[model samples]
Target: MGGPSEEPELWAFLESLHCGDILSGTVTAIERFGVFVALDDGPAHSVFPGVGFISFAELSSRRFEAASDVVQVGRRVSCEFLQFDTWNLEARLSLKATQPDPFQLFVDAIAVGEKLPGQVTKLIPFGAFVQVADGVEGLVHLRELAWTPVETPSDVVQVGDEITVVVTEIDRERHRVALSRRQGSSAV
Candidate 1:
């Protein structure tokens, strides 16, 4: 029953659906209520979900303004169809609603007291967001950045520079990771 119209997005998805199909979409809009994603049915087709939702903070690992920066308008994202209403002509889309969080993996992926090398991605007032591994990073808080109180993270570590850190804590429940460098190398 798929036909070309102003709602090609919705129609394409209906045709592709098999009652439990997994789909991916791009963020179309972010409203006060929730985020809207244009379903990727193929060749840029989409579907609108009236009840779908995503938090703005979750859209980005941290800072977010432009949805494109986090969820591109045309980027395909993995999602599952929670439900679809024929009479209302709406669908429910979600990422967390379907997939397990990657951050949670860090809880088991990283081990406490183990040393992992990380790259300084950014320097902040608090510390640095080091990329310890592909998607794993732990904060080297200002207190942990040096043997003594340091004015800034740049003093010892700069962006793009690699540093070794010991896994201080891996909070699985909170999905928080704590890393330290003070224990690995002696300060001179």
Candidate 2:
């Protein structure tokens, strides 16, 4: 066999698993791209100690600087089986799937046209990102920075400035919040 078919036993074992099934494993390696796990019930990987892999995005819903931010080597974890990586001959798992999604919770509790107090966290050329809640940020576009014409987001609001904003649009599918400081000021 060639390509992904090189590991028949591993392929058959991974094929037996289903998405959302809970898989137990020990953290084997942490790479910039993802984490590798030694699954408790699956056959050994041809190279790695484990046949389970978790990409950085699947490690957690929260933003992090490194793989160690969510897990460490030798830590035991239970993750949701997401899919089989036919190319790598590994099972793809999600640690975040086993935990609550903060974005979802935030969305459920908020509504459009709501006024919120937030602190500017990042200032980009087009807009500024304001943190309304922990790990929850909304964008205040340059045009919405103020009623007056502005060349850049910094001209209206600098990073770390506390400001009030009105939620103009809530994109549930895209996990985005479009805000307007001008509307918020007028609404106050």
| Top candidate by lDDT | 2
Show where candidate 1 strays beyond 4 Å: 1-78, 81-92, 96-100
Q: Model 1, range 57-108, lDDT digits (tens) per residue? A: 4453443456555564445576666565454344555555454555765565
lDDT accuracy of residue 66 in candidate 2:
89
**Model 1 RMSD vs true structure:** 7.1
State the TM-score for model 2: 0.88
Q: Quick one: RMSD of model 2? A: 2.5
Q: Write the per-residue lDDT of candidate 2 for residues 1-188, one digit (tens) a residue.
A: 22545777788898899988999999999987789999999789888767899999899887778899899999999999999887777889999999888888988999998999999999988999998887789999999999888999878788889999999998989989999999989632
The TM-scores of all predictions, comma-separated, are 0.59, 0.88
Best by TM-score: 2
